[model samples]
Target: METVRTVCTICPSACGVLVRRQKADIVGIEGDPESPMSKGFLFPKGLSAIEYMRHKDRILYPMKRKGERGKGGWERISWEEALETVTERMGKAKALCGPQSVIMLRGAAKGLPDILLSRLGNAFGSPNITSMGFLCFVPRVYAYNATFGCFLYPDYDYPPATLVLWGVNPSETFPPLFRRILKAKEKGTKLIVVDPRRTESAQIADLWIRPRPSSDILLCLSVIHEVIRRGLYDASFVERWTLGFDRLERHVEGFQPQVTEPYTGVSPEEITAFLGFYTQGPSAIQEGNGIEQSLYTFQMQRALYVLEAITGNIGRPGGKTRWGNPKLVERYGPLFTLQDLIPREVRERRIGAERLAPFAHYALPQAIVQAILDGSGPKVAFIMGGNLLLSWPDSKRTLEALGRLEFICVSDLFLTPTVMMADIVLPAATFLEFDSIHMPPDFTYFAHVQQKVCQVGEARSDVWIVNELAKKLGLKEYFFKDEYELYDEVLKEEGITFEEFRRIGFLLGRKEYRFYEREGFRTKSGKVELWSPDLESYGLDPLPKADPSSLQSDPSYPLLLTSYKPYPFRHSNFRQLDSTRMLHPYPLVLIDGKTAASLGVKDGEWILVETRKGAARAKAKVDDVKERVVVMEHGWWLPEDGTFLDHNINVLTSADPPFARETGTPLLRGVPCRIRRL
Candidate 1:
């Protein structure tokens, strides 16, 4: 048996793992004993590595669709044939649609693939290349980018003061993290959870504010109003480190605690009490699921940051601090080797102008998907690395738009539902057969060595596939000599050497920047912009506030429908991860026990659910889990049982833009809907 030390890319948690293989086949998998995050243990999903490699669904060779799109028919092709076909078809698309038409989409959150995807896009003369950042975490990234001049998350070291949770439930989504959070809580960090559902984490909190979904901005604004009105804010800090104070002061003039209540459902007293927590210095405002997944996510995150900024609690031991390590960070310090290498004319009309801020993605993937559907700037798409069903705005809409693409090329490891829409589908290497440097999801700074543990019949890494295409299309010099050469180029200024990365499978750099302390913001004024010049430049309102509240518009869709990453899985990433799949054999919609009683819905029963966009059915999970909502786990595809029923949540999700808010991201969570018995 040959044992390899690598990290699991199944999810962003970045668990380090040890994959033991019998020759070219995986035999055993376990957590890296020396891993700082999981500490030598693995989540069940990671433990099932062998099973994942041996699963029946894994694409073992390059397959050309034998019939029409979504027909589930394919014929195996040799590497030469596959590459030639891709080169010819994609070249035609590029020649007709312009290089801008060919886009690169990432499926995995692990940073390694980005290096290749970006390179592939650049070499192929395409300017549009993106990941799921826009849909999931880019809002937080954008907010920090706009304000604090950094995207470093606070070090979450809540000690003495209150820990305010703005609707995030990391406990259930990441149980291993929950265990650590519990330990932190046990040491006297006060917990305050703000979510519509009384989740397990909220139940343990000192205070829980279950406001109506999408009312987060309103709730945060009301709290800010209270903090300012009660003379509880750190006024001196605001004056020194931030700009647009006067504008914000004027903007919030009309939004008193009472005015915000009808929208947020949070009482003035609760707002008053929550504001009271900040007086005790050295606290952190960790945003919850609600704030992070909504339309106004960026604004909500900024509002939460305001609490920290105004309190002057940053850079101190326990507050949301600031971080910056120039020699180390892969994202910001200096552009990596392949960054901006794409030709100027090719990048002239940046396709994602609606959702992104120039080269920086506000939420690139989510915005670009809309751009594709709208035919903004460019119209064709060449997707790699990302699974649209799981990461984009709405699965059904994405499928529709893909069908309309002048040409669509899907490079993936499986014939997933998303792949079913591609005009040309290419079988790519699974993570197990790929060699790339991975970053840890939890720790944020650590890097890992991801080596191939087994071979998938003739499947090659997406890196090789992309590089081959670039060469065939005649961009030889722009492409990498090999994976090793690419790493050398990318690592040119990023400091970490391949030698060092391979030794321990992880390398830790110095602690990064914390909350705004002597912080220089990135906007025109170079201060934390309460009302940014950047926003004003876009001719949009600079300061964020609650959306017009009077429109609880749709009467037919009465309940707010939303989804979250469940503990057993990380969206579709783990669908084929055997251990995690066994946890939930079929997708189910979680309904509150009280709500189910009112609707005469019982546990484990299938029911029909429809929204204005579309309709589907999911098994009802009526339990004492939480209340006032329907909780369907995000990321499962609609089932194909030959019955007249559907299973995917994307079918019902809306593809509307400005649902594409907060700088190009769409509101994927907290969707408003109503459910009935089938």
Candidate 2:
């Protein structure tokens, strides 16, 4: 038997794992003790990667739809035929309705596919590259980059005097970070968790503030208010290293804790105490994707960044800092590719650019859905590594918009509901079967080479499929011929060979602390802009303030609904895997026991969760939570039962208008909902 060291891409945690395999058969899998970030920690999803790779329903060959779309009928086809048909159809669509009529959509697979798909679309002269970015990390990425000239991430490597986990439970989304927080707690690190639910982290948190849904911006504003009013802010840092502090002070005059308490549901005393602890010393704030799903996501993130800046945490050793190669200069791989391909005319045709241009670079998925429904959108689509029907908001509209596409192709590991609606289904290799690069999504300092362990059936890597399709489309000059060539290209400037990277298993970057002390922040003012001049030019709120949520509730629908993904599952992936499924057997709606009793609903009873848009059935689980908040698990679909809308959470999520003016992200979280016993 031989052991292979690789990183797991099941989630953004990207834990390092050692796979023990004998020839083509696998023995077992365990955490790599030498991994600096994960530090021998592993998630259950990572352990079941082998099962998912070897599952009976794993797509191993290319197939063409044999019946009507969404009928689950397919005929096996050669890779050559699949490539030819896909390219020919894409060409036809582009030629008939211009390049803007073709769309390339991507999902969770980050490293190569995420970058390559946009390049592919732009290389083909389309500007309709869309994903979950409007509802995910893109807003934070843009907000931080605009303010700090780069994405500022929490420094988890160093212990802080205080750590504020805002709207995120590391235990469920980021297990490695969760372990790090636990270790920090052991050393007397003051922990503060700001979430509506009593999460695992909240159980041990020194302070847990449960704000109302869509009220986090208020909480953050109140934190800033208390800090400034109490004169606890770092005066030296603000005057020397930051711009617009004076503007911020005047702007926050009316945002006292007593005034914000009604909007945020946090008392003035609680707000004062939390900020007092947070401002004591070096503190780090870790915001999660839960905060990124609201209609006010961009403003909310900007508010959090302001909070971090006022406390003198920016560019600090134990606070918000960059954690990558400081000396590395050259850009390579897909990052470089994304810049060179798109022409200006095509870029001008982005779907939601009119509304989201200031805050985001890409088109919104909801805009694409609306365009398709109105018969003015892309006629063809190439979906890679995502289940749009199960992952995106409003499964009904996603299906309808996808069904309208003249040509559709889905590349994935399993035959999902999204796959059932495609003209061609390309079988994609798992992470274990592909030698690729893994960059931690949390802005960590290291990168790992995920060496291919073993080939599983006839599945092909996404890079290979993309390269082959580029060749078929006569864009061969744009892509590398092989995955190794791509790897070498990405590492060409690093002074390391691909073989050396594989052998070393990782590449470490020198940590450069207090980066702004010498070079200054790379913003318009060359200082941290507490009140953004860039935002002011666009006539948007320069300072972070609470905006009313897009949706409101009346007497008919009185509860607030927010969606959460379970730890064992990554969006819609791995639900068919028995190993992970055993951990969470059914779709659950988490509500307070008191709320359930008041509504005449019982624990473990089937209930109809209804919103103004739609409704879905979910089993109620009573827990200690805020009475008005109802949390439903996102991406719930059964392969055996094979019903897309019956129990899926997206049925109740709206795909309509009143989106965030900056990011075009619709109201997925903080939606108005109600529940009744079924």
List all candidate RMSDs to the true structure.
Answer: 3.3, 1.7
lDDT of 1 at 641: 30
lDDT of 1 by residue, 238-276 (tens): 887878777776677777879888766678888767766
TM-score of 1: 0.90
Model 1 sits at a Cα RMSD from the real structure of 3.3
Give the poorly placed runs of model 1, Cα more than 4 Å off.
1-3, 21-27, 157-160, 276-278, 324-380, 440-444, 494-496, 512-526, 576-578, 623-628, 638-645
> What range of 10 consecutive residues in model 2 has the weakest lDDT sum?
326-335
User: Residue 665 error for model 1, in Å?
Assistant: 2.9
Going through the candidates in the order shown, the clash numbers are 23, 0
> Which pairs, if any, clash in model 2?
none
Deviating ranges (above 4 Å) for candidate 2: 326-335, 338-340, 548-551
